[model samples]
Target: MENERNEDPTDWDQIGFIISSKYRTAVLEQLVDGPSIPSSIASRTSLPITHVSRALRSLRERSLVELLVSKEKRKGRIYGVTEEGKRLWERIEAEGMVD
Candidate 1:
């Protein structure tokens, strides 16, 4: 979906800042079910591995979610949603229902 439109810079920025792209939203949804590896996220979301990785990087930069841990020799890195991420998920779901 396209980003919500708003003339007020702050209002637009508030939502747009969280989900700047569809891939980012997909990444968030994957985490909502539970923590999983990036590969798992890609499989579940049907997003390209490269896109998922990029989205995860952006999410991490914003502190919306975090890599909980890496297991078994730096493989199977589990990611979890932070408090802010949850709130954003709620907003996205709510808006989706309206749409």
Candidate 2:
């Protein structure tokens, strides 16, 4: 879906910062196709759950990622990239920001 928010040039800096971490980049890569839980992401990326959790938090704070379920639930809090996130992901891919 198209992002409702206008693209901000400064968002490049935030995107750059987020993808700078290998774990966060891996997390984003996994989410590109669809939403997933932290455990799934960690397993797929072969990263620790704690690390993935941290990455998700950072992504959420940037509005690049969002939780699909209640925080209190905890067991299956699905995370997906926002429309703005998709736009940023495309830019990052076009620029070859990460492999």
Candidate 3:
């Protein structure tokens, strides 16, 4: 489904579908607060490390989030919303789409 194209690329309704998984949404929420690594996200959200890793992978596949840096001794990554992600997030918030 990643290859599906929308007439409007900025459509949150469509982007949301990709990121609508409960865990994925939670991951986005964690990133919303600030840039964080997977371990921090798991700790803060009370999610398993493996689940967070899987969610992050899915999010990256959809271009909703990005890996910032992984250097030195830090094996984790910092994730943040992309421009496309921000636009979709704004639209979702404006539409009161959150449960």
Off by over 4 Å in 1: 1-14, 70-73, 97-99
Tell me the TM-score of model 3.
0.75
lDDT of 2 at 88: 84
Give the Cα-based TM-score of candidate 1 against the true structure: 0.76
Point out where model 2 deviates above 4 Å: 1-7
lDDT of 3 at 95: 65
Tens-place lDDT per residue, model 2, 10-42, is: 787877776789988888888888999999999
1 versus 3: better TM-score goes to = 1
lDDT against true structure, model 2: 0.87
| Candidate 1 lDDT score at position 4 | 49
lDDT of each: 0.77, 0.87, 0.76
| Per-model TM-score on C-alpha atoms | 0.76, 0.87, 0.75
